[model samples]
Target: MAQIDYIYSAHSAYAYLGALRLYEICKAHDVVLRHKPVLLSPVVEAAGGLPFAQRSQAHVDYFFGREIERWAEWRDLPVISCRPTFHDNPLELPNGVIITAQEAGLDADAVSFAILQAHWRDDADIADHQTLHALMEGLGLDADALLEVALSPDVQEIHRRNTEEAMEVPVFGSPTYVLDDDPFYGQDRLDMLERALSKPFAASNWSNPPVDIKAGS
Candidate 1:
């Protein structure tokens, strides 16, 4: 079976938007989806993208605020009008997802969408254990056992490793699918990713261009 390194933050809107489609595609293609939930901050910074908080309102409106509307309608996903109540909260729930995938050996695909729904639709605070536990229980999973493993230092370390790997690779945004070292970033590129899966594309011949500079005239 072909493998993909699926990298994203657990609470990311884009990740939520593409999660189900990506999973279905992989299942259809006999592919393995190894979900690697990561710390999105350092990775975005390394890739020279602005944080959501720091971006201008117009940028957020178009890229994030509005894109959410367009994609939710297009993808038939439910979403609240406002941003997730705890969207900017610390990443324990994000790490919990990685831990769930690693220590519990559960499908991160299911857990990922659940958490995303909890935050994005139900307006729950994913940083809260109650919310996480409730979401896990909803899936008929052993919430206690999963949470125990998810909170362990070993699993946390695994998540840290994932974040470090993401930063080093410069995966700029959420929902990045890497197949054979070729990265397709964003939910918008998923169709392209599906195409690439069907038939690998020719490698790009483009190279980094020389920097242009000029002294004050």
Candidate 2:
């Protein structure tokens, strides 16, 4: 079986934008998707990209402005015009809880998509414990038990390992798919990802293809 390693930030708008389509692709092709939630700030810094706050105003505006609107419409995912209410806070808690769920024999895709929807669509604060508990309950999972494991040393270690792997891959942003040795960044590159995953042994190169962000929109 082929593996699709998904390296993303829980709070990334891009990840939120790409979540559903990625899920569909995995389901259709029977791909094994691994959710690796890493801190985007450090990954971007390590890859020589500026943090969100440090980036030029033009870039920030483009990201939080028309780009988001266009992609949100294209992907048909709900999103706020501005950043989400809890955008500033880290989503490690809920993300860690999802990781715990995965370790506890829960379907990772189900838990990951649920977490993303809770934040992006429902406008829920993923950093809030109660919100996470509610999400767990909604998933028919034991909220208290999962919350306990979410803070456990074992889950924390898994999260740390995910971060380390993301750093080693030199991933610069969210929604990154690493198949074999090639890295496909951005949600729009999912089509190319699907093609690659379906033919893992093929000798085609798609890493860093010329991407026209405005053309598709």
Candidate 3:
């Protein structure tokens, strides 16, 4: 079976924006979508991207703020006008839940989408046990069983491994879809991704900047 590796953070707004469309494409093409939830900060830093706090106000206002609004409208998905209330909270629990769901052979896609929607659309605190329990229960999953395993060292180790793999894959940021080892970095590239699924793109001949050249030299 052909597979597309989905590498993204649990609380990512862009992931929420592309969640449904991505699933739809997977279903249409009969593709196996593997959800690999990751730690957003380390992945961003590894890819030479600035952390949210370190970025300039203008950049933040445009990309994280206005860009998100535009994409939400484009995707026809509801999103909070501002960042979620617990947007900065630790991701271990939420990320772990998705991992656990996958490991348990459950409906991981539904589990992941529910958490992403809750964070981006409803402003739920994903880090809180009660909130996570409610989310699991809402899906008819065993909230207690999932939460207990989600916090276990084993599940956390898997989360760590997923983050490491994302770094190794050189994933730029959230919502990267890897098909045949070619990475489509953001939700904005989903159209290209869909096309590639039917007709694989030419092999990459990617190049980097000259090491000696600085920006605007």
* Top-lDDT candidate index: 3
Compose the digit string of candidate 3's lDDT tens values, residues 1-217.
Answer: 7899999989998899998999999999999999999998998889778888899999989989999999999989999999789999999999999999999999999999999999998999999999999999999999999999998999999999999998988988898999988899999999999999899999979998666535554
TM-scores, all models, native as reference:
0.93, 0.88, 0.96
How many pairs in model 3 have backbone atoms within 3 A of each other, for residues 3 or more apart or on separate chains, i.e. clashes?
0
Model 2, which residues run further than 4 Å from truth? Answer: 200-217
Tens digit of per-residue lDDT, candidate 1, span 1-217: 7899989887889998998899889988999888888888888988778877799988888887889999999999999998777788888655665567655677677888888877788888888888788888888888878877776777788888988888777798997899988888998998988888899999999987654535422
Ordering by lDDT: 3, 1, 2
Q: How many backbone clashes does candidate 1 have?
A: 0
lDDT (0 to 1) per candidate? 0.83, 0.81, 0.93
Q: Could you give candidate 2's per-residue lDDT for residues 64-167 as a string of tens digits?
A: 77888899899877776676788778757876887888788887676777777777777778888898888888888888998888878888888888888888
Q: What lDDT is reached at residue 68 by model 1?
A: 95
lDDT of 3: 0.93
For model 1, the stretches where C-alpha displacement exceeds 4 angstroms are 210-217
- Among all candidates shown, the one with the greatest TM-score: 3
Ranking by TM-score: 3, 1, 2
After TM-score superposition, the amount by which residue 64's alpha carbon in candidate 2 deviates from its true location, in angstroms, is: 2.8
